[model samples]
Target chain A: MSNKYRDKKTGITRREILKVLGVSALSYGFLGASSKVYSKSTAHIVIVGGGIGGATAAKYLRLLNADVKITIVEPKSQYIFCPGSNEVIPGWITLEDLMVTYTTLKTHYRINVIQDKAQSINFDKKQLKLEGGDTLTYHKLIVSPGPTHHYEGIEGFNKELAEGAFPSAYSAGKQTMNLRNQILSMKKGGTIIISSPEDPYRCPPAPYERASYIATMLKDNNPTAKLLILDSKDDFIFSNNYLVYWEKHFGYGKADSMIEWVSKKKGGNVVKLDASIRAVITSNGDIHKGDVINIIPPEKAASFALQNNLAEGDWCPVDFFDFSSLLHDDVYVVGDSIEGDPMPKTGYIASNQARVVVQAINDELHGREVGSPFIINDCVAMAGQDYGMALAETFRYAGKGKKLGERYHILGAEKNKGKQIVRQQVAENWQRTFRKDVFE
Target chain B: MNKYLLRLFFILSSIGFSNSALADDDLTGGLSLKENFELAKKFPMPSPWLLSAQCSACHGTLGTAFNEIIPPLAGMDKQEFIKKMQEYKTADASNFIVMGIIAQPITDEEIEAMAGFFAKLKPEPLNQEKIPRDVVVPEWAVMNKESE
Candidate 1:
C-alpha cells in the first residue's frame, strides 16, 4: 500500500516504460522487414527478341527471381532454331520441328509475351518504342535482335534472287524452308554452288555444315549431282576436322566424289553472281554454271537495329555484365547483335549471355552485388548420321582482357565401338537437354 | 483552475507520444518492402563514353574501321555480336581468331561496354575495297560441259 502511494506520487512504472520501448522497436523492425519483402516482389525486366538468347533470358530470369515481371517483345509468332537447321536441308527434319512459340515459354515460366518489333529505345526515359506505336517502360531492357543479310554487294543478287536463285537461309524462317525445297527439287545431274561470305557472319560452321548436308543428300539421292563450295577464305577454322569427316563420309578427294571444296587459295572465290544466267563469276575470270546457287552475302546488324539508332558502326555495343547497351544504358543487347571477343555468334553463346544478363539484372534488383560470372559455350556440327564434332571453351572477364579458362574438343574418332555408342548417346542427350533448356 | 489545466495538458502530451510510437513501429515493420521495390525499379545506366573508348581500340574511332581483319562495327547485329563474344569466351564455333582472344579477358560488364559502343555507332557502308577478291576457292576444276 505504501509502495503504491509512492508510485502514484511518482511519474511512471518500469513495466510501462518497457512496453512503450518494445512497441517502438517492434514497429521499426516491421517497417524495415515489410520494405524488404515488397522490394523483392516487384522487379520488372523487359527483353527484346524471341530468339534463343531472349527466350532463355526470360526463362532464366524467372528462375533466378520468381518475383520479377518479365516481358519479351518479338516480331515473330514463333522461333525457328538455326542450330539444327542443316538437318532440314537433308530432309532429316522439317521446319515444324524447329519452330517454337512464346506461348509455351509464357505458360511454363509465367513470362509476358508481346508479338511486336521494337523500333527505338529512349535510354534517358527508360522506355522502348514499338513499331505498333506503343511504348513500354522497363527497369531493364535486353535486346537480342539477330543479323541482316547484305544483298547490295553481290552484283545482280538481291531479295528477289534470294527467293529464287540465291537463298541465304541464314535467318531461320520461310527463307530457310524455301532453300530446303530448292535443294530437294534440283535435277539429278544439276550443279549446286554454295558460296561463303566475308567474315563477321552468323554461324561459322554453318556453311560447312550446309555443304556437308547437301553433299550427303546428293550422294544418297542424286549421285550424278555435283556440290561445289566456293569459299572466300584461304582456310577455315575447322578445315582439317571438316575435311576429315568429309573424306570418311563422302568420297571426298576422289575425282568422281559428289563434294568439292574450293578455297580462296584455289582461285575459286566468287566476285559476281549473274542470277539471270545462273552463272557465278570468280575473281579469276572463270564462270561456273549452277542450277542451284546458295550465296551468303555480306551481313550487318539487323534492319530494325539500324533503324532504331542502336547500332554503332556495324554492330551494337553493350555492357558485358547485364548486356546493357552502351549508347543507351537502359537497353541491354545480347546474342549476335552485340560485340564480344572470343565468343562466337552462336546460339549456345547467346543462351549463355542471356543467363548472365538475367542473373545480373536479378541481383541488381535485389540490391545485392553480382557475383563473378562464368560463361561457357559449345558448338557441335553433325558431319554424318551418328557422327559429330564439337568445340567448347569457357571465359571470364579480367578488367580489359578476357581471360580464357578452359577449351575442349569432342570428336567421335578416338573412341572404341563401345565408347562410340556412349559418345553418340551423349550427343543425342545433349541435343535433347539443350532443346528443353532453351525451348521448354 | 491553473493546477487542473496543467494536469489536463500533461495527460494529452502522454497520449500523443504513445500514438506516435505505435505509428513509427508500424512503418518500421514495412520499411524494406517499399524501399527495396524502389531500388529495383531504379537500375543504374552505364556511361556511353566509357564504352566508346574501349570499342575504338578494335572497331576504330566511332566504329569506322580498324582494318580488313576486323569487320566494321557500324550497323552490326547487336545480338549477333553479343552471342559471338560469348562464344569466344566459351569456345563456340567462330571464324575470327581475335574474337576468342579478345573475349577471353572481357567481363559481362566489359561486354556491355562494347555492346553499348556499337549500339551508338552510326551505320556506314562497308568499305569493300580492301576486301581481297583475289582469294582463291580451291576445289573447282574448269570443266567443259561439252567434253564431259
Candidate 2:
C-alpha cells in the first residue's frame, strides 16, 4: 500500500488491479492443485554473525526459498576458519589458508552482507538495532555470534594479558600467529604450558591438537624444549590417539618425556594465573612456570546474546526441533552459543543447526508443519600430519522440551600406517571441501 | 492504453500455464493426484532431506564434492548408493575411516529416501575460479576434475 512499493510510472487503475487479483486467484488455484507451490512473501530474515552458522543459514535458506530477503550483520569482513587452524602452528597451513570472505555469499547467493556490529534487538518491534544507528526490521532473526571467551574465568588472566604476552589462540586470528611465534623463538629446554579449559567449550579436541602440533614444532625447532598440557577436565575427546602419537614421537611417559599432560584429577585444574612470573596455579595450590603460556579461557554465550536476554545462564537454550530460542519467539540461536549438549561445539554441527532452522522457517512460510531435525556431526581431527582420527555423532530429536538423543562412534588410533595416512588425507581434503561448501 | 491493457490480459492469463501438467490418474490408496499431494504435504516426518543435508559438511552441499578422496554423492545411482551405504554400515570397522560409523545410525528406510534424493540431483563439477587464489589445490584433486 505504500507509494515506494507502487509502480509510479504505470499508475495501476482500479480495473487493472481487479483484473490482476482475479487472474492471480485463478492462477493460485491451478498451481495449488498441480504442485506444492509457495509464493514469494516479503519476508526479511535478518541474521547476526557471519560465522559458519549464520552464513549457512543465509545460503541454505536462499536455496529453500528464492524470494525471502536475507541480510547478515557481522562486524568482520573475512572469517578465518578455526577447523584447520591447529595445522597453522606447525607451519603445515597458514592463517590465509583458512580465511574466507563474503564475496561468494553476496554475489552468488544475493544475500545482503552488512559489515556492521549488531548492537541490540528490540523483540517487540522485531527490529535489530545496529551500532551504526540503523534499525533493520525482520520477520525472523537468527543469532549465531559464536562464543565469548570468558577470560575472567581464571583469576588474574584477562584479555589484555592474553593479547600481550600469553596468547590464548582459540579463535585463530592474531593470537594463533602470536603463539606460533612464541613457540618458534622460545629458549632451548624451555617449557610451553597449555592450560585447557573444562567441558562445554568450542572444539573439544582443539587443545590436544594444539599440543600435538606444538610438540611437532618443538621436536624440530627446540628439540630439548618441553610441552605441558594442563587440562581442567580429566579426559578429552581424542586422548587415545594423542597418547599414541605423543608416546611414539615425543616419549610421553618417559622421565625425560618432551610432552606431559596433567589432568584435573591430578591437580591440573588451573584456578589462577600469576602472569608476572608466567605461572599458573592449579586447584591444589601448586605453581608451575613456563616460558610461554597459552591459557584457553572458558567460554559463555556471546555478549550480544547476553545483552538481548537470548541466553539463560551461560548459553542460550533453544528448541532442538528448530533451534528457535526458548526465550524469544521470533528469534533463533545456533552455533557455540546454544546449549546443545552431546553436540560438541563444532563448525559442522553449527552448519547443520542452521539447515534445520532454515528448513523450519521455509516450511512455516508455506503453512506446512516443521519437520524433525536429524543432525550428524562427522568430526575429523589429526594428532599429527601423518596420523588422523574421526568420529561420527548422530543427534536425534526426542520431542519438545527434551534434549536430543546422541550416539557417538569414534575409532581408536589406527595401528596400520597405511590406513592412518589415508585417514589423514581424508581429513585434510574434508577441510578444503567444507570451506567451499559453507562459503562458496 | 489499449496495447497496455491487452499486454496485461496476456500476462495474467499466462500465469496458470507456467507449470507442467500433473498426471490425472488416481495414485496409491485410491487418492486423486491433488489429494495425494495434499497427503504428502501433511506427512509429519521429512527425515530424508534433513538427514541428507547434514552430510554437506564433508560431502559438499547435496553431496556434490570436489575433493578427490571423498566421493561426491550427487547424481549417484540410487541402487549403488544404497548398496555402498549398506556395505559400509555392516562392513568391518577398519575398512572405512568414518563412513562405516557415520552410516550406522541411519535406518534402511532413511537410506532409500536419501539415495533417491541424491540420485535426482545432477552433479556439478568444481568451478576452478571459485577456488580461492591462495589455496593450494591438491594435484590429485586438480587432475581428477571432471568436465561439465
Candidate 3:
C-alpha cells in the first residue's frame, strides 16, 4: 500500500491526485444533499416481469442489500426497450439494439432469473404460482408486468390488424417492422394515419415523435406523402417542438404540409376502421382514409396483473411513496402498470419508481422509517434528430391525502441549435445505454 | 523555422508549463461546481455512469462505493475528475497499466458526463461499519471525518 503512490513518469499516482485535492470535495457537501441509506437483511424478494421496472428493482435491491435473495420471474429470455424505439420508424436503430437478456442479473448479482410466466399470486400465503406448475414463496413481491393493449376496444381493429396490415407498433418488436415496411412502401402522395391514444400511455410523446420521424423519412424518399396524426389527446407532451420541427421540414399548417394533427376535441378519437377500404371513422362520423393506418389503442395493466387482481380500475393503484400496491399487501407495481397519473408512463419514471420501492424495502429490513420522498421526473422528448425539448418536474410528497408538490422546469424551445443537437444525441444514447442499465 | 530550435522551444515550453502547474501545489481540475451543476442539469440521464457505456461494470452509477483497491470518482472536484480522465486516455498515464488502457478509448463527451456526474453526486462519508463488503475509504474521506 505504501508504494501505491510511486508513479514512474511524474511520480504522481491517483493517490497523489486525491491528496492534492482538498477534503472539502467530500466534506459532506455532496453527501448532505440527500439522506441515502445502506443496510442488509436476509429475505426472499420475488419480482415479476423482467422489463425495465422489474430489472431495475432487482438491481437496486441487490445494490442496497448484499444478502437478500432476489428471484425475477419473467416469461421471455430477453427484454427489448421501448424508450427510443420510435427511431426504428426512420431506421435510426434496429430491434436487436433494443434487446437485452438476463445473463448479468443471474451471474454477477446472484439474482435468479426464472424464465416462466408468473401465473398468479397466493396473496394470503405470500406465494407466487408459475405457469410451469411451480410455487415460490417470498417475503416481498414486485409486480412490474408492463402494458397489455386493448386493441379490440377500437371497432374493426384487433390483434390481427396490428400484426398484418394496419400496425400499432407500440410494443416494439414485430409490429415495429410492419410499420417501418408500410412507411417504406407507401406510395407517392399516400397518407399514413397515426391514431394516438388518450393520456396515461407509455412515452406520451411517442405518437407525435413517430409522426415526426415518419415525416422525416418521407421527406428523403416520399416527399409528397402526407402523415396525419389523429390524436385522442388534445395536446401532447412536446407539442411546440413537434410543431416547430414539422413547420421547418414538412410545412405544418400549410396547404402542402406533409403533417397534420387532429386532436380529440377536433374529432380525432377514432371509432371504427374499414380495413378493406384502408380508412378509419372518427368519433363524430368523419371518415379519413389512409394508405397505412397505425392505431395505438388505449392501455391498461397487463392481463397478468389484472387477472391476478392487481389493478383497481385500468391501472394498479399504489402507495406513491413506496409504490406498494394499495389493493394488496406485499405487492408493489411500478412502470406503466401503476396508477401513476400526471406521471406519464415513461421508462425513466418507472426506473425512478423502482428506486423508491427498493429504498422502502431496504429501510423496512433495516427497521428504519422511510421518509417523505422527492420524486423528480426529467421527462425528455425529441422532435426528429434536430429539435429537442424537455419537462423537468420535481414531485415532492407533501403528505397523505395531498398531491405531490410539483414544479415544471422545461428545457424550452428557445435554446440554441448546439444544445438541441446535443440533447438529441443524449436522448439517443440514453435509450441504448438504459437497456444495459436495466438488464446488464 | 529550424528543426533544432523548434525542438528546443517545444521541450522548454512543455517543461516550463509542467513546473508551473506542479509548483503551486493546488489540485487541478477545480472547475466551479455550480456552473457544472447547471450544465449537467441540462442532461437527461439520471447519472453519468449511465452515459459512460461499459464503465459502469466497475464504476457505480454516480461513481462511488467501488471495490476496495480502486478509488471512486464520486465527490471528486469536477475539473480534477476531467484532468485525471484526460491523463488516463494516454497509454502511459500511470505505471499501473489498467487505468490508462480502460480509459484510452473514451470520448470527450463521455468524459464530460463522467466529470459532471461525479461532481453533482451527493457525498457520503465512508463509514467502515456501513460498508460491510470490501470497500476502501480513501484518504480524503478519512481526513474529512477526522477533521469533522
Candidate 4:
C-alpha cells in the first residue's frame, strides 16, 4: 500500500530489495550456509516395471533417502524370475519356486506399489499417464520396462504362434511355464529344435543354458530324444565352455548324443517356419522337422519406451552416471532397455545399474557433490545340471569434465568339474539371496 | 597509553601468525596441488612384501579363510580383485561387506600387489587331518546344505 519508486541504477524497486534481503537473512539464519531449499516440496521418484532392475532401484532409493517419495508402477502383481527358469524345463526347480510378489517391497520397504502400466510420458511436463486414466507427476522417473520380442523377422512367427506352436518364453511368465509343460509332454524319441538369434539380445548365455538343461532332462528321462540348437552366429560367447561341459556330461560329441549344435556359418540359419507342419526352412533351402520348435526371436526396447518417444534407434541411451535419458531430461532408463557398450543385459548388471541410479537421485536431492560413479556386472550361465560359467565387468565414469573410461572385464571362466559343484550351489544361493535383496 | 598500544600490536601480530598457520594446515589436508600429487602416487603404488603378512592374520597363513563366508583369495583373478576393491570403495553390492571395509583404505597399487601375491600362493589343504574323518564337512557347507 506504500508508494514505491524504481532505483536509478537498476529497474528493481527499493522495496523489492529490502524484502529479498529480509527473506535471505531469515533463510540463512534457519538453514545455515550449506543447506539449500528446492522449488519442489519433496522429490517424487516413480519407477516403472517390477523386474530385478526396477525393484532394486525402488528399494535402494527408499533406503538411501527416506524423505523422497517412491512409487512403483508395474502391470503384474507377481514376477517369475527368468534367471532360473531354465531349470523348470529339467524339473530341477518348479515354476512356483521362481514366483515373487511385491508384498515385501510394499510392506517392509514402504514403497507404493501400483498395479498399472505406464502408458505414456510427457517428459517436458514431468508427468506420466497410466492406462487406467490416472496421471502421475514425478520429479524423476526410472523406466526399466525390460525387453520386448521382435516378431517381424520370422515369416510365420507371431504372438499367437509363439504361444501355441513355438513359445519364445523370453519375458518370464505364463509363456515360460507353457513351454516347460510342452517339453515335458513330448514323446521319448522326439526331436526338439531351439533357434538362437544374433547378438544384441537379452541374456546372451540363456539360449545355450536352456539347451543344456533340456538335454540333461532328455538324457535322464528320454535317452533317445535329440535336441538340436540352430544358432544365427557361428561363435557364441559361451559356446566353447558349454560345448566342453556338454561333451563331458552328456556325450555331446558322440553320434547318438542327445544334444547337437548347428551354426549358421555351418548352414543352420532358419529362414522361414511352418508352424502347422512343425518344420523350419533353412537359408540354404533345407527343411528340418521337429516334434517341438522353440524360436528365440530378436529383441528391442520395451514397447512402452518405443511408443513414448524415449528410444533413439533400438534402445534408450542414458548418461552412464545417473542413467538419465539422453533424449529426455526427466526420464531415466535402466536394465535391458538402455544401451550400455560393455555391460551385458543380465539380471545382475541391471541390479547394479539400479543402485547407481538411486545414488545419483539421492545426491541431486541433498545438493551434495556427486562422486565418481561406477557400474559393475556379473553374468553366470549354467550349462548342465552342475556345470556353469561366469563373466564380470566394471565400468567407471569420470566427472562431468572428462569422458567415461573404458569398461574392464574383471572376471571370466570356463566350466570345470570342481568349479561346477561350487557354481551349482552358488546359483541356488544367488537366486534366493538376490531375489530377497531386490524384492524384499 | 604507550603500553596499551604495544599490547594491541602484539595481539594483532599473533592473530595474523595463527591465521597463516591455519592456511598451511588446510593446504596440507584438503585437495591442494601437493595433496593431489601425494594421493596420486600413494593410490597406485605397489605394496611391499610385508603387506602379505598383514593379510595372514584373518585369512590364515596362506589366503584360505576359516570358512566359505571368507572366500579364499588364493588363485582369485587379479582384475576381479581390483574391481571388487573399487566396488567396496563405493560401499555398494553385497557378499563382501567386511572385505569392502578392509579394502576401503587400500590403494589401487596395494590391490594389485595383494592380488599378485595371492595369485601366486599355492592352495593349501585345510588343517583337517587332526579332526575326525566323519567331521570333514566345513560348517558353512553344512549350513548352506551344500555338503556332499
- The candidate that achieves the highest DockQ relative to the unseen native structure: 2
What is the number of backbone collisions in each predicted candidate, taken in the order shown?
105, 0, 5, 0
lDDT of 4 by residue, A177-230 (tens): 667767777998999999888777888888998988888778777788999988
Candidate 3 matches the true fold with a TM-score of: 0.71
Order candidates by DockQ, high to low: 2, 3, 4, 1
Q: lDDT per residue, candidate 3, A1-440, as tens digits?
A: 24322333334443343233223223323565311222233356889998888998898788777776678999987676788778776777666656667766765666777888999888866678999987776667999888988898789989988988888999887888778877887788899999999877888888888888898889888888888999888887767567767888789999888899999999998988899899999999999999989999889889988898988888888877678888888788999988886566877777767777877887787877663343545555678787655554444444465444444433335234544554464455445445555765
How well does candidate 4 score on lDDT at residue B65? 38
| Model 1 / residue A132 / CA error / Å | 1.5
Model 4 docking grade: incorrect
lDDT of residue A319 for candidate 3: 79
Q: Which ranges of candidate 4 are over 4 A from the true structure? A: A1-41, A398-416, B1-148
Q: How far off is each candidate at the interface, as Cα RMSD in Å?
A: 25.3, 17.3, 18.8, 21.3
What are the DockQ scores of the candidates, in order? 0.01, 0.16, 0.02, 0.02
Of the two candidates 2 and 4, the one with more favorable lDDT, higher being better, is 2
Residue-wise C-alpha lDDT for candidate 3, range B17-119, written one tens digit per residue: 1211111211112123233334333433233433331233233343453323234567789899778877755533421212432343334665787788678
What is the DockQ score, from 0 to 1, of model 3? 0.02
> Which candidate do you rate higher for DockQ, 1 or 2?
2
Worst 10 residues of 3 chain A by lDDT: A33-42
Error of 1 at A140 (Å): 0.9
lDDT of each: 0.62, 0.79, 0.67, 0.65
